[model samples]
Target: MTDRSFLDWPFFEAKHRAWADEVEAWAAAHAARLTDEHDADGSTRALAAAMGEAGLLRAACPADGKLDVRMLCLARDILARHSGLADFAFAMQGLGTGAITLFGCEPARDFLADVRAGRALAAFALSEPEAGSDVAALATTATRDGADWVLNGEKTWISNGGIAGGYVVFARSGEAPGAKGLTAFWVPGGLVRVVERIEVSAPHPLARLAFDDVRIPDSHRIGAAGDGFKVAMATLDVFRATVGAAALGFARRGLDLTVERATSRKLFGAPLFDQQMTQGAIADSAVEVDASALLVYRAAWLKDQGTPRVSREASMAKLHATEAAFRIADRCAQLHGGLGVVRDAAPEVLTREVRALRVYEGASEIQRIVIARAETAR
Candidate 1:
């Protein structure tokens, strides 16, 4: 079980504690089935639907038709600790539907209603073959027609790429080149074609999509013509801290598994936990987990207080937590020796899941750049 002492901190309220407990209980009951890597799309979609049915997804959206970043962070931390797939399911629900919550018009809001109820699976389509962290380099184009817009381009590494019911696509409007020319649109599925679904080490379903003369009504546009950059940034800003929360969850589980194995295994005719080296490793894991929790919750608390932006804090949390999770998982795997490398070990699963967190959202290198730029600007 995770340390409940953090709940006593002033950063969290009674309601937050209650919500965390509920999510933790739900996860304990569901994580086992979702752990199967086979049929990842089926597992993820089922988990998403179950999360929605439990009313937990309601917390993902706010009453003002926006998202509360703090709640998102809390939920991700709780769920990820229990199951990575559960965290993936919940995080995608918010990320895929973020533009709609932040900048969607009346019609867009209506479309998002399906998302809130889990009737629609949504996706964010911003990264292209050439643009990952550098949003300014996106080459997807959207040209205006009589009463519609024609979109053409390819988006790669999109989460829920093949399974999403619809996508919030970002494309250049030709108004101006680079970031200024960008616009966001709500494009329903089947309009765009899935070119390829990339298989990676982790075994989650990700794909590359191609928009060949895809026509969407002007009404599908999310914000102003040149406001795509702002919309994307706003959405990412709200959920950025939650990425750290997810990493923390993975770390906590890795630590727990390590501790359990250490206490049970024997070395030198004594329990492995009795060794000084084992004790030191356990202490290090505990300290890192606490440090990560502090950083992640601090970012969430700041955002919930209505801070305009938290780029510095969010980058710090994502960088530190994700890096820490990788280290914690690696150390745990090492402690497990030959058995750790086996797929069935809990620590091995954590090792695989945590490996990808460092690359997604923004890579560790990109987070460092964000942090350095923010510090210098200050």
Candidate 2:
């Protein structure tokens, strides 16, 4: 069990606590199916359907267009404690439809409805081969036609790339130089072709997408023209902290596994816990887990309290928690000896699951840059 005491922190409300309990209870009953090692796409699709049926995905994009960051964090933290695929399914629903929730026209809003219901998958296509961290250098082009925008470019590292029902694509519109010259579109999956499927340590429906002169009606545009950068950043801003929450969950689970092994596994004619080295490892893991929870929840609380933008806080949370979670997971594997290296073992699974959280959304190095820039600006 995770340290549920975090629920009592003043950062959460009675409602947030209730939501967490609800998700936790639901996960306790249904986690086996969602967590099993099925094919990546099959399992992800199954998770989407199951979570949607449970009404767990409704919070991802609410009808009122008001996102409760705390609720999002709580759900991700709890679900991630159970399984990373569960967290991925839930987070993508929010992230994939985030722009539509905030700035969708009627057609895009309809798509958001299906995503929230888990009838379809959603994806955010913002990165290109040459423009991973540099949003300004995006080369995808969106040219104006009479009633449509012709899109042409390649997007790599797109989550739900082939499986998603629709994508929120950012393309350069030449509104101005660099970051200013961009537009966002809600392109249906029918117009896309998968260029390549990306296989990562943790399997997911990741792929490279090629948009060859695909056309979306002007009505599918999100935010103002040339505001694509803002839309992408805003969407990322809301969910960045939740990335840390997921990391916290992974770390907490690792700590629990470590504790169980240390107290029961024998070494040198005594429990492994009797070893000074093992005791020190346990103590450090506990400290990192708690510190990560504080940072993760603090960022969520700041966003929920209506901080205009929480880039700095969110970046700090992502940077520290992800970095700490990886370290803690590695330690979990280390303490488990050779069993940790065995495929499908708890420690090995967890170690693989968490390796990507640091790189996706925003890389740790990018988080550092975001923090440093914010501080220097302050």
Candidate 3:
């Protein structure tokens, strides 16, 4: 119901357009039952099951083990427009299982079938209390013990934390310092304990996990011991552009709400749309939305076209789209006046939900740094 005209852009193909329409239709049909507004964990579980049953999770795990970045972006964009929670549910499934799809051994690959089927939920455990954007600061350790690795440490801000069936956990395994010593492991969720459930301004199934002598076989290790950083970066590089696409969804929805309010509401003996200020806000939001779409699809397109890594492009897209979405949401809230401040009002809720997108999956500041580094190197 928002604007599908963006699909006509050259960045997408006929198949991408068809897939986008299908996802939008699916989201519309299922949005009402897909999320429980009051229960983050419950809603995530239910949404995952529903997405699995619909075979939508297949986009997250293609048969060839190579994810279609364009399809991923299109799906996230459409789903986020319908429901932020739905977008979160879908994004986490892809992100949580990404390392496995990209670098896992046979056992890790076997888990993908259950994950895609929604019988098993997946979690990506990368962030810790001290290590967030700074991956080199991670303190978690996985020590070798004969055929198994004993994992001991804590991971925080984990999506699908308490509810996930398995986790892709990164920890220090070698004597080398910094990211070079880190390794990625596939740990069964039952082996770890959730220390605390986190509640955000926008509800999500986030938690802190503790690993106390948890043992996973060497077969569960993803990539090489020193390649954890590469695996995590590669996984992130692929999905980061999709984050921008999700922000575009939120911005599109916010702009639609603002347009409705502007056209229907009256102020100073005239329709709100007649006011220059309202017109400027709408125009600015539209431009931002289009700009966001351009950057998001550009990154996705580049990756799909065989660019080994689109880190710089992905960072720029995420940085701009998330920041622009936040601004657009704020403007929409302002245009709504007192109605927007109502706790659960559409614009208010969107504003709150979009706020977190700026911080997660590499914060805006980190994105700036990445861009600067890339530009300077060029």
Candidate 4:
């Protein structure tokens, strides 16, 4: 129903196209089971398991351990089109375990298998109450003990916080200030306590975590003590574009619902689509969707081509696509008139989901700064 012609773009290979088709089919079959209004956490866990069973998670981590950004984008795009919760489950799995996949020791590999199989939930704990886009401002600390590391700080807004089997926590561990002092640890959920469960407009298993001297074995260290910042940035570089793809999916779905409504609903004794104003809105939605796809796929393609770091491209894609999707969702809601504002309506739900995308990963303001920095450096 959404635009499949984008698959023909040179950005994707034959295998990527095949994988996209397969994922879309799987999502179609499992759409109902992927979302549950009564139990958000349970549904997320179930969706992760289903994705693992369907072998869709293989794209999250290939045999060679190299992350394929294009495949990741494809999966997110398709899954998001079907269910936002499903996309959340899949993205968190990839993100939570990404540090281990890219930099973990042999022991961390064992945890990743559980993650891929959906037997264990994973989370990324980098942001704190005080530190968000400004990673240098993180206050979490990891102090060395005799043979272990003690984490003592709080992480808020963590996805899969209460349910994750383990977390890739970033903390200050050295004398240097800012990001240079940070370290990454793979801490089991048992070591930390869920201080509070965060409820958002678009529900997911988010929580605030408290680490009261949580002890973890030194083996759980992801990289060198000073490598946490690098690890986090690298992981984000790979996933940021996929966020845009997810936004694109939401925008595309909103557009489709709008088209269906306009064509079927009539006003003033004619179809709603008959109005020039309606036509203008539809045209704007189409352009925004296509433009978002172009930016998203471009970033994915460049990452796949072995660009060591794609901060500029990734930020551009995320900023443009997320902003565009929010606007498109708002426009769709406006077009739907009274029905759009009703609870659980397609446009209303999409508006909430798309709004969060603009804030997470890196906010639009941060992305603009990143882009500006890169341009000035050039």
Which candidate wins on lDDT? 3
**On a 0 to 100 scale, what is the lDDT of residue 323 in model 2?**
92
What value does the lDDT take at residue 124 in candidate 3? 94
Candidate 4, number of clashes: 0
lDDT values for all models = 0.86, 0.90, 0.91, 0.90
Alpha-carbon TM-score of each model against the true structure? 0.97, 0.98, 0.98, 0.98
On the 0 to 100 scale, the lDDT of residue 110 in model 4 is: 72
Badly placed stretches (over 4 Å) of model 3 are none
lDDT of 3 at 137: 91
Q: Can you write out model 2's per-residue Cα lDDT over 244-355, one digit (the tens) per residue?
A: 9899989988999999999999998999999999999989999998888888889889888889899999999999999999999999999999999999899999999999
Q: Taking the tens digit of each residue's C-alpha lDDT, what string does model 4 give over 123-225?
A: 9999999999999999999999999989899999999999999899999998588888899999887888999999999888999999998988889999888
- What are the runs in model 1 whose C-alpha is more than 4 Å off? none
Q: Over the stretch 337-369, how does candidate 1's per-residue lDDT look in tens digits?
A: 988899856778889989999888889999999
What's model 4's lDDT at 218? 89
Clash list (residue pairs), candidate 2: none
Tens digits of per-residue lDDT for model 3, 299-336: 99999999998999999999999999999999999999
lDDT at 252, model 1 = 90
Candidate 2: lDDT over CA atoms? 0.90
Judged by TM-score relative to the true structure, which candidate is superior, 1 or 3? 3
